[model samples]
Target chain A: MQKRISIFIFLLVHIASINAQEAKMASIKEGSFVPLYGASSKKPTVVKSFFLDVYPVTNEDFLNFIKKNPSYSKSKIKGIFADKSYLAYWKNNFDFGSANPKSPVTSVSWFAAKKYCECQGKRLPTMEEWEYAAMADEKRIDARTKTEFNTYILSWYEKSKTYENTIGSTFKNYWGVYDLHGLVWEWTSDFNSIFLSGESRKDKNNDKNLFCGSASVNATDLMDYAAFMRYAFRGSLKANYSTRNLGFRCASTTKY
Target chain B: MKKITLAILIILSMQSCKDNTQNKNVTKEKPISDLSIYNLPSQWTNQDGKNIELKSLKGNVLVMVMIYTSCKAACPRLVADMRSIESKLKPETKKNIKLILVSIDPETDTPQRLKSFAIENKMNQEPWIFLRSTEENTREFAAVLAVNYKKITPIDFSHSNIISVFNPEGELIYQQEGLGVNNDETVNKINQEAEKIR
Candidate 1:
């Protein structure tokens, strides 16, 4: 009788893991758009068809992740991979505490988030893929130009402690993805590609000495100040650093 | 017989639960500092096509820079800067230091290409190593170095000009940012770090 129960438990755990590995995701179609940074202003970067998580990764999902990958657990994590504040809100390695189980996980470093996605057999979205999917509002594919669209994002930026909110509380975009803007900032696979800030200065406006090809890749639309803020935020980040208002979701080239 | 099978099954499931973390954290040496680059688990191939991990290079002070062999704009000057730093080092310090050029454009800068570039640049000798890895690993490595780069065209990349110095323990000690900047501070730091290594 004990042998039968053990076999049943094994099968149950295996199925549960398999389901976690394949979470809810939205299929994003391929298209082209000029981003606020990283390409020549006149040129549009093409995004291949991909899958994105419908919502940001929640504290519940991440707890499952750390249970399996304990090297990333709070105590065992190498200092090179994450900063001191990583998962600071969680009570311990196994529990996220009184924070809502369904709330989006925050204070995760780029390395931890990257590993979480890789273990899922997926990868983090490129900055371009992220910006492309995020360009949509509830009704339109390209809504950056709309006053209401920009206002909503800008207001979310003004709002304090939105990271405490649950995922999918925000409106779904054109691609059926949620919380691209209203939730915490996310880590991109190539967030380091952006070049702005201290590198640019007087007479250094096109500082070829500090960075290569900076002259040609100015912001395509200065009016999209909202996107510019995201680019600047990415520029300021180091991979090992984590914060209370930062979180991430996985993306994949193939549908699961 | 059923009892034996179930025991094996329980053991197997426990091992599987530990599988993900086991593949990483390959090195458990107590002395390796938490901030050391040796903690990175990625594998890399050198100009000679030998597989290496950052931990294997632990005993030498590392003077590392990221560049693509194909870069025409800043890498040539960066290469000159690296050579200049090497030239100024004392023979004793040279014994303890390795000047490394890591490739950001791994897709095009194959081991063969790196070998030829090393030969052409007259860097195919002691203390100069060229390394490349998978694109994902390269990105992760770049993140560690805080070196930012992007491909502007099919054949060209835009990258920052930075040379990072790490102590023998694989902890980053100093960084020289910008092209053709003063190397006095960098060389002194390298000498100072190398002196401690011996």
Candidate 2:
């Protein structure tokens, strides 16, 4: 009888773990919208229906990742993949220090975030797809026109130490995804594609000397100040750069 | 018997999960510095239809630019800039440098296409290499170089015209930006890095 009980317990634990290993992903339906900048000025970039992580990749999740791939750990990571501050907030190479393990992992470079997604059979969201999903509020799909939506994002910009909060702490949006705002700035796969030079002089006029095809890419909505800030921030980022407030989540083409 | 089967099944699944993150591609080598581009593991096919890793050019100063074969604008000027930089270098210094043109449109710029472009442009010689890789790897490479590019149409891509110079250690030493721009400074930087190779 004890032998049978032990077998049952093992089976139960195994099944439970299998379920836990599978991260939850929210299904975002196919949609089309004109981004502030995209493939073109007039044509709306069409985003296919895909599964996005319901929450940002957490410290607990990243710890598990480093356990499997030690090369990505703080000490072991290559300088080509990240800068000196990669995981600087962590107490040690393996420990998250005073950080909440349930909180989204920050101070991760685009390369590190990208590898994390790829290891899980997923990929980082493109800027178009990320903006498409993030434009939503609690009810509407395209919420940039909503005054409150813009205000909420702008207010979060003013808030400090928001990265300390755990994933899913913020209000879930229309697609049931949380922490797109009021948590941390996330890395997109093609963050380097932005043309707006971060230097005040270059930002004043779209400098032709700095960009090869700057004229081809333009802002469809100059009024979206919140998104403009996001674009400018992305424009300034190099893939190897890691910072305290920046984090990322994974997205998959296939539904899980 | 069922108990044994269950245990084996559990072990197999766990093993596969571990397999996902195993260092399958990395091989034993002299410990690469964190800042070296040699740490990148992407593969490429050269103009000669040869599969090569970036590490193969490890000890040579790399002067690299991105271009597409079909491009009518900027690429010619960029190629001219590379050639001019090459001409300005002392023959001794030139021998230690590899002028590489990486194709942004890998689909159209196959090894054969690159070879023809090399021959037509009179660069099909020693110290001049043309390479193309998978679209994903190319994008990652561009990100490392901080070169912004986007496919504007089916045939055209708008890419930054920046020539990056890497030392024999695969560490970026200098960058010359803009098309048809004076490359005197860039040439001097390249010579300075190449001089260290001896």
Candidate 3:
């Protein structure tokens, strides 16, 4: 009888251990605001309430993911979903050498980041949600007009190798989210939706005829050069492209 | 002893099922090239409501664009661009090509809608394929094609105007950007690829 009782306890513990640990998330109340893009013209866009991770995804978290989904490991991942440098920094499939485990995992492609979120039953935040949450300073929800807020972000852009820093190492925002500005650039679900200046000759013709309805889209706030940098960075990304300073976090719609 | 053996067999069968599903295409075909789009595993539905995988179109040269049936602006010219490309191709090479238009708005563009659009555009004949899948797969496919798109209103979307060509092995070979640009280069590339299959 004692042996039988012990066996039951062991089975319960084993089953619990099999499940992946859930990441902590903060609740963001739904609100409306006009971001630089995504709104109809320059009108306000309504962002429904969602939950977002407090910090960017860390190297340790991704390591746990690849353990369960071996197909996504650096050596085995399909070429269509990621480029040759998907996890160039990782020393091996299960090991991340010389890099801090708590630092945000960079050099991950959009497809790889999307898969990571899905495995956790979460998804990458839409661009509106990301921009909405990011606009906040430590005190105010919308700080685009604040000179200090814009300056701080621009300074971080000038900083080198901030991706090597640990997550949650920067100031917490009004939404209780951390490292939104000072860490690394993140991938959004709709990152490809952006259309910047018709810089290229191909795009010059495309803007007139190829993208017929895009005449309505223009920079809503040219003074907010920090936001413009983010939009331009998103515009340049292809799904399979990965860089050393690019990472992402997960978000989910909140249910009452 | 008998019960334990039976339990083990059940567990083994479940493992086999998982493996078969994951390796479904990899095992049947020669190893897919690292750069081939056929490596994608997402399932899609064609205009006829038949479910198919991208791998099924492996043997033909592919000319693909992303557009919705409801677009008021760029999609029409994009479609016209595709049609003009097809008209310019040599009659012999046309037999070995498939011009696919994947819908960015899957919610509104059903298989029936796609089929009707095909008929309305006089593209109901051979070598014209219309495909729509779940929204997630659509975004992923757009990413692969470097096609940017966004829904602006209930019935309209703004998207990049680019047409891509793929060789018979599902590797991207050439891309023609912008609207109504010269098709001579695109046509030459298509002819060259088709020549290889002949």
Candidate 4:
């Protein structure tokens, strides 16, 4: 009887654990996705998924990063890090005594932005992922009518404001991601890489060599025709360059 | 036996859930497309110093080229290429399409300088505009359009010599590379792209 009771208790415990595990998995599986525009179609031909940031990284968040990683601090930085644009606004505007630490950190270089995400055990979203998230919802499509999106995007270039309050202070995108297209231009991990040429949808075999130059003749030929021009454009930007409009967000793979 | 069965079922359910979660996190990837070069950043000043934004050019098709007044090598050829294309357009098509030359050298390419550059190129026409912006704004704008440029020295610059075409709605429709190419072929391509928007 004692043995039987022990076995029964064990079974009950295992069942509860299993149920909990199942619930966790379900939540992760329900990840959000945004779609990309096709050549001939107005609607997205492909869907790209990403994380939903409740808010942009605040000044406090960046300060914490600096505290943890001394290398990124003003003193330890070198070479491209020495550019005036790197910390011009942030250093001048930030008031340690009065500034809101929770505000999103601005005036950071693309390299620094990447390092910040790495410290947090997260990664920046790729440009494709960023665009997909921005245009996720059908309902939001009407809002982003050519006129409105153009106007909104252009306005940022015209006006010159030093600091914004925080990330969520502005409008949110379709996937509930805040300040994607507006508040600041977030940095992406693959923003500067030359993407593998070729149609993303048709190439199902996932050829790694296509990314490099040494792929098979067939693959190279396929890539030359299928690759988009935007990839080439991204490759043009030098890493040392920094601008006021640039900022970043973090993403982590869902641990199962 | 009943307890054993229950335990096995729960474990299997848990494993299935984990797999589903992993699947959900995996985002769908897609190929990027060739975006129009004209869909660049906004609020650029024309050669005449008028504030021009992409939206403001909504009614007419636009042909865009990048130049700096200080450039001695490519700017002349680029302007000549644009003129050659303009000459080939039909009277009605010419009336509909606007030619724009944006200055990558914002610091030195002032309104007066841009105007003189246009005059020297004999591009003093209805649609031609020489544009300039602040250093910060221009760099951001250049990045958006993927127009690579660097100060080879203080006075001279090296930049990608590409011309962009925009539709009436300000979407980047097409791009032509380099200054000198098959002029007739280029003109035909431009006219064909312009007609789509018209």
Candidate 5:
């Protein structure tokens, strides 16, 4: 009888642990915004979620990938492969002897970034996910304030340095993700499609190719004035164009 | 014997519990198509100085790239690269594709400026239009595309370089970054993805 009672208690405890595990697994939703940077009072645009890295695949990561899969080496890549700008600075200028293996990679094309993410059982985040993460902390205001929001954002650019380092070296956002705002511009998995005239944001169902969107604000405010400048920057790029600042990180579905 | 049987039963139940937890983990991945972009405010304009409503470009693939006419270095190269992809397509396939260039430089890229810029670039392709929205709408669009840009100076802007592509049904198909250098790969990927729609 005592053994039977002990068995019943053991079964209950095991079931409870399983229930807890299931709950943890079920939490990641499609628009799950993990807050990286906290909100600033002036520019209330809260960045709730973002990629953990600033740049794309680097030479170090790609070299290891090539070592594992020799078919993807430079010789094997056909027409319009990595250009001189892809790894120009890193290979020729920087000394990476002390770089970390798991740091965000640099000097890779969009194809190479996608391929590297795939090989690692991961994929690039969608544009929607990326923007959602960026503006997670962004807020729209009727008027602009003389505050640290714009100052801090502008300061990020001034302090911007080379691509030789990994993410998380600077201050991290609320979600524990690193290097979203200041590092290098990461790549997403969307195509370079623009929105048409008479397009309704609600009916975005028709134009599936449109990957870019932004927050709403009045044009009168000085701070809100150049919002369109942000959108056009991404639309102007071709796929293979890699610059000193362009880099990417990978995201997995949690299951993989 | 009875004691042994009870212990075995407890162990079996625990094993089954572990399997259930694993199953829950497997279901967390949602399909990409299930996601949608957030809506924009009313009263927007296209790059060609045309009023924009959401209903006009139904049942067409919308490819959007953001740029300013004043951009000397990356912007022109991006347009040329996109043109290369557009030129390669069959006319009929091209008809189904809507190429849009949204200007981030709203201060300078007025409706007239956008219109002239489109003509200068030979962007007369059907359903291809350039647009300039209010600074608010532009930001909304940027947030949706995940593209980031900030003005370093009056004429110069520091921004993320990327292109966004959507399918005929308005589902985000793929995005390619790196403009002039990645043109061939970008075009190939877009063509391959567009072919899979039907």
Candidate 6:
């Protein structure tokens, strides 16, 4: 009878261990805002109502994800799906070493992050959605004009390796989301959809050769240096490329 | 035993479904390389409204470029560049190759629309293929190719113009960026890859 009881407990524990982590989501109301960079004719782009994870996907959540989808594990991921440094901080295929499990998972490729979101029946937030939600501070939804909000984001930029910190350690924003700043940079669904001027300048004498209609996409707010940095950083990345300070969270269109 | 049977049933069903859709000569199955575009499982529709997997195009060297049909600026030049590349390759080399134009604006560039565009551009030929897929797949493909594109207005998009070359094995071997740039190197790469096919 004792053995039977122990077996039942064992089954329960095993099932619990394998279950995927379901992060809490914040409902963002649809709104319009002119972004610092990307797809602009100096007009505000409308972001429809959607749901976003309160925090970036944590190391613990990712660990659970890989366990369920073994093909996406550190050693097993295909070269086309990720670069050499995918999950480079991890000790092995399964172990994350001494890193806190609650810390936001960094060094993850866009493909891996996209797959994680898909498995959860979600997706990586669009560039516009991410920028819109990220603009919020504790008090105001659109805090891009605020000096303190800019300082806080820029300060986090100067601080090296804040990805080591646990999720939700930063202050919650107006939209009830955390770690939009003061944490690792994130992967968005449309990260590849940015055609910035830096690359256009590199196009070198042949303006229209590199991009179609490059003249139209000028930044509406050039003073928002912090947001500009984000756009520039996103432009530099390829899908398979992974970095130590980059991670991602999933978003869904449905509020549920 | 029942589980194994069920899994086999699923696999069989998937295979049969695939076979019905793709009606080309995929003679022998080869192990897809990890770096191959065939590794992507996204389904695509051709100008003829036929469904295809990227793997089905294996054993033929591919020269691919992305363009939206409605674009007034770069696409025409991009198409001209593709045609020039095709023209440069020997007729024998062209037999072993497919020049693919994938649409970035899938909603605007339907199979019927793609067909009209193909006819309009005089690319409605044997070697020229026009393809479109779901928005997600199109985005994923663009990500793989490192082609940055965003919708500016309801009708306009800002997009990078790059022509990609893939070997017969579906691995991207080379890329020639920019519109109306020299295609000499791009042509050479295609001819070299196509040589190994037959």
lDDT of each: 0.87, 0.85, 0.86, 0.55, 0.53, 0.86
Per-residue lDDT over A1-256 for candidate 2, one digit per residue giving the tens place of the 0 to 100 score = 7877787788778666545656789999999998887566568788999989999999999988887678889998888889999999888878999899899899999988988887676889888889999999999999999999999999999999999998999989999999999999999988877777553322332446556666777888888999999988988888989998999999988975
Worst lDDT run of 10 residues, candidate 3 chain B, spans: B12-21
Model 4 Cα lDDT, one tens digit per residue, A186-227: 665555423333433122333231121112112121222212
- CAPRI accuracy category, model 2: acceptable
TM-score of each: 0.91, 0.88, 0.90, 0.40, 0.39, 0.90
CAPRI tier for the interface of model 4: incorrect
RMSD of 5: 16.6
For model 5, how does the per-residue alpha-carbon lDDT over A1-256 read when each residue is reduced to its tens digit?
Answer: 7866887787778556434322111111334332121111123332233333333455565665665444345444322334445544443323334555445556566655666666655566655455554442234211124355445545665564545566555444433445655666677665233332223233232222222221211222345322233334455554556675667766555553
Please state the error at residue B164 of candidate 2 in Å: 0.9
Candidate achieving higher TM-score, 2 or 5: 2
Q: List the residue pairs that clash in candidate 1.
A: none
Q: How do all the candidates rank in terms of TM-score, highest first?
A: 1, 6, 3, 2, 4, 5
User: DockQ of all candidates, in order?
Assistant: 0.50, 0.39, 0.43, 0.01, 0.03, 0.44
Give the winner by lDDT.
1
lDDT of 6: 0.86
- Flag regions of model 1 displaced more than 4 Å: A1-12, A199-206, B1-31
Could you give candidate 1's per-residue lDDT for residues B27-112 as a string of tens digits? Answer: 46556777899877789999999999877998899999999998878899999999999999988768999999999999999999
Pick by DockQ: 1 or 3, better one: 1
Q: Candidate 2 vs candidate 6: which has greater DockQ?
A: 6
Candidate 2 vs candidate 3, DockQ winner: 3
Model 6 regions more than 4 Å off: A1-20, A200-207, B1-28
RMSD of each predicted structure: 3.5, 4.7, 3.8, 24.0, 16.6, 5.0
TM-score of chain A of 2: 0.89
Q: What is the lDDT of residue B77 in candidate 4?
A: 79
How far off is residue A176 in model 3, in Å? Answer: 2.0
